[model samples]
Target: MNAIEIINLTKYYGKNRGIIDVSLQVKEKSIFGFIGPNGSGKSTTIRTILNLIHPSSGEAYIFGKNCEKEYNEILKDVGYLPSEVFYYSNMKVIDLLKYSASFYKKNCDDRINYLSKIMNLDLTKKIEDLSFGNKKKVGIVQALLHSPKLLILDEPTSGLDPLIQQNFFNLLKEENKKGMTIFFSSHVLSEVQKICDEVAIIKEGRIIKIEKINNINNNNYKRIKIEVNYKIDDTFFNNIEVTNLIKEKNIYTFMYKGEINSLITKLSKIDIINIWIDEPSLEEIFMHYYDEKM
Candidate 1:
């Protein structure tokens, strides 16, 4: 069963464009990434899927059910963490969580307890007293308390520290392992790279590429770092299909997505002191799409 299906999904705010004919499928029990820069329609698409805002055209489905029409029914099995975290400021964390749990049918006490402990959340603290990061932790715990089958997160690590972010990613991986499908939307390419099984690159409100993680990391993309005997012009390295090229004095770094033979032949012509070519990070590959017209 597919986790989510968005077909020709377009949203417009009055005369302004949100997304245009956007379409994608997130497989069941997989970590799928929806990546783009700010104002690239990530939030618009997500809100449309959740039926928080009706689409201008086309449809969204979750677990084979129409999201707009059946949201009341479908949302029961869905967990969501928005890009921003907000809660009743006066309530204690435990109280807020319990109130949220009331909306679901199942008993989530054990689930909340376990998630809170692992997330290092102090439930006794009042929501008003918590820092931004702590508030985010509460949001995570509340979203997962019901053990929903579908998880939707948008820039979930915004206020979290590096250690907490890693812990959150590991928690998400564990949830995915247990057959919870995830739709993660973010501008942080590194975080998405660490966990997603597949990635869809969105540019100017349209998808430019949807590829498996392995294919993107291993094939058709290489991170090249070169130490040359002399300064190299940016245009000199432009002969090949390179995405992001940077030259700081004698060291040149960039991502290449063409035939290895071509890159090797080009490097052979130059007086190279040392060269290292390896798998390019998703961030490196994303820069190709990011630079397009907004």
Candidate 2:
């Protein structure tokens, strides 16, 4: 059974588009990544699913229960971390955690302690004293304390340092191994690429692509620069599948998209001394998609 199902789920805020005809299903025990830029309705969709906000139309289900009707029951087995962290400033870290843990019937001290150590959160500090990163860590601990079956985290690593971000990923992976379903929402391409098994890219409140991460064409075009001992004919540019070609003296730089075998064969015929090929990063790939949509 899918852990979550959103069928034609849509929301509108006074005629302004929140999301339109959005439909998605997250499989049980899988890490699903929801990706989009700002004002793309990601948070709106998440809130609707959690029943924190009412949807104007369509339906959402968690564990086969209607989201709106069964919100209380569904929430009992779900943990959520919002995009923003808010708590009483005067409360100590331990006090805040205890208050959050009180919502669940299960004892959460051991889980809280374990997470504190794993995340390196200082329980003695007051909420107001913690840095942004530390405050996010506290939010993480509270979300996991009850050992919820499903975790919904929105921009979970926003303020975390690199080390803590890595640790958080490890924690999610470990939880998934124990049959937990993780729904991770983020705008960061690298974060989604590294941790998500499947990802859905949303733009302007619409899903543009939803596919297995392995299926994405991450092998984008490469930029190649070549320098030869002798000046090669400009005719080389004519035969080569090159874009944005630049030539000066004996040096040439261009972008190539197809198989490298043919390009390599052509290069071998020339007295090439220096060469460089720039591979695209995740950010570039994401931008490529974004540009295509525009």
Tell me, what's the RMSD of every candidate? 2.1, 3.3
lDDT of 2 by residue, 1-294 (tens): 999999998899997999998999999999999998999999999999999999999999999999999999999999999899988999999999999999999899999999999999999999999988899999999899999999999999999999989999999999999999999999998888898898888889888878887756445477789988787887877888776677888778777768799889988888888999886545555666786678
Compute the lDDT for candidate 2: 0.89
Q: Candidate 2's error at 139, in angstroms?
A: 0.7
Q: Which stretches of candidate 1 lie over 4 Å from their true place?
A: 230-239, 292-294
- Can you write out model 1's per-residue Cα lDDT over 1-294, one digit (the tens) per residue? 799999999989998989999999999999999999898899899989999999999998999999899999999999999888889999999999999999998888999899999899999999999999999999999989999999999889999999888889999999999989999999999888889999998877888889998888878788889998787766786587776777788888888877899788888888899899888778877876567433
TM-score of each: 0.92, 0.85
As a whole number from 0 to 100, the lDDT of residue 31 in candidate 2 is 98
| TM-score (C-alpha, index-matched) for candidate 1 | 0.92
Worst 10 residues of 1 by lDDT: 285-294
What is the lDDT, from 0 to 100, of the residue 264 in candidate 2? 95
lDDT of 2 at 225: 90
The alpha-carbon lDDT assigned to residue 50 of candidate 2 equals 98
Structure candidate 2, residue pairs in collision: none
